[model samples]
Target: MKALLLVVLAALPVSAKLVSREQRLDLVRRARLRQAVDPSTMDLLNGPQGDGSFKVGEAVSCKYEEKDPLHPLGGHSPKFPCWTKSGERLKVKYKGEANPEVYGEVAGSRLLWALGFYSERMYSVKIVCENCPADPWTSTKESPRAVRTFEPATVQRRLKGTEVSEVEGEGWKFSELDHVNPAKGGATQAEADALRLLAVFMNHGDNTANQQALTCLEGDPDCKAPVMYVTDIGGVFGGKGYFTSYRHWTKKKSLWKDAGNCVADYKTTDEKSNDPEISEAGRKLLADLLGKLSEKQVRDLFLGARFDDLSKRQPPFIWPDGKSRPLTVDDWVKAFLEKRAQVASARCPR
Candidate 1:
């Protein structure tokens, strides 16, 4: 019976083509089945270690292949480029029996179910292992481990009103607004405000991966606000302290210093020291934005919570001398919402 099943499975089609970004996102969003068994029985041939484990929020390495139900076996292949719902470009990698042929068919049916739980969408490719069996296939027994690889999706340059370049001496430039103030341009003001809020949260969360130039949008020369976007947030909520805590401190120092320096550099009056390329209005706008922030707001932005929460939960990070803190994500979220409401009401005024 096993021999017959192997013969039949071997005859079945096995390979597939690369999926477009739209299709891949759709699969991740809508797919109901989070896990699938390898039909090729490669795990049996290669032993339990060969089976792949899939977990929520864990990054997977996969590759793209032409869609074909009848191809042979292999593993570890390059993937094709795709886009995310947030308009960011990404690539998908496939491992195990996740080849295009298997993935394409399964993805269409399973995607919607997957999205019901995970708010974020995902893209996936397929792979094949040559040394796998073809009958009585079982999910390989092995500890769940996510494959590690640098995702190129987050690379960004130039936002509507921002010019991001690594020019020596001149420093990062945003030429849209006058010197020191970021509010000169209406659109720039909105973008800057959004980034400021985001930066505060990121700083508190200690998200180093996002600290660099990750989420930036290009186009719209008239607007000069730096582009910021949130990519892979898996590391946001929970993780080991060694990796997460270290990153927290490292990112905090780097972002705080760079952001503060950038603000100070643009706000300075000395044209010789300031980048000549930056507009006076832009500098003024940055200064005004920074100026509007109270010391408490700055602290809150960095600490991310009310004093009450901190007393109860006691976050992992040490509070600066004489500083109050918040305890939970809920507490921080509530405070953030309240502050946003106040800012909106004050700025927009009915």
Candidate 2:
């Protein structure tokens, strides 16, 4: 099927009048998905593997490979693709050392992986591209020379799964749990509700329709019981503008609007947040997972994302400024524990 799609597409003229841009891209996406999938290798929680857990400061050399090559729209966050020496294709989304999203994305995925969820097999690795690109995250341009890229850049091995959502690129919604829940989509309802709570915990500000994905754990085209997973989590751990502000994040740590009825009132941009109500099971599940984190593991969450170096930036952090203050590992650990305490708080809805 993969070969046939390409063979047929290659035969068609570039000027095919009837095909829309979406149609053409969908064609390419499906073909690539089929070609790259290895059914036996499919595992939702397959990582936060050796690469994501260990490669900070030490540069992992890679050759730049242009995937999108061109960003349809220009943006600040520069994310592009590269192939490591071991031949793993990774998506690198790095802004710089000062940018909190770098830490947020890595921490979010790693935390999710730790909590036993299907998440990006992402690691924070220093990058040196042999054939570097100029703003490759949004432009197709490249440089011929080797370039040292951002520090603590998130390097995530691409995830593969059969599409289970009705819309291809536009993924499922928090409202549409039937598309990914076990009672309906095969993932536990507690998992779905816990995700909503998790989004609030992070004060997620970029929960777009396409951010979460619904897909089968298997690579089979006919795979049923698809599970939902967060495909991109870069904009977490902060509120408006996705800033890694300690004051803002810690200031509003409450997870409930009406704890007795299990209502949530944290910040979010997801319009599909209404259907799933928080349950005791969901809250407990998250709290239980968080409770399992050892002291070292809890600290690793921020250290892995390079939160310690944030205070040492050129223009050092100042007091009373949440955004400007240098958030050390200690600061993050304290905040994290407080947040965990909120999750496990005895005052939660029964």
The CA lDDT of each predicted structure is 0.26, 0.59
lDDT of 2: 0.59
The total number of steric clashes, by the backbone 3 Å criterion, in model 1 comes to 64
Taking all chains together, each candidate's TM-score versus the true structure is 0.25, 0.74
Over the stretch 67-149, how does candidate 2's per-residue lDDT look in tens digits?
54243323356676677777665667776654566767777776776666666556677877767765556444444445656
* Model 2: residue 199 alpha-carbon error in angstroms: 1.7
Q: Highest lDDT among the candidates is held by which one?
A: 2
Q: Write the per-residue lDDT of candidate 1 for residues 219-321, one digit (tens) a residue.
A: 5322233232222222221121211122232333222223322332111122322222222343343333434444443333323211222224334433568
Task: Give the TM-score comparing model 2 with the true structure, all chains together.
Answer: 0.74
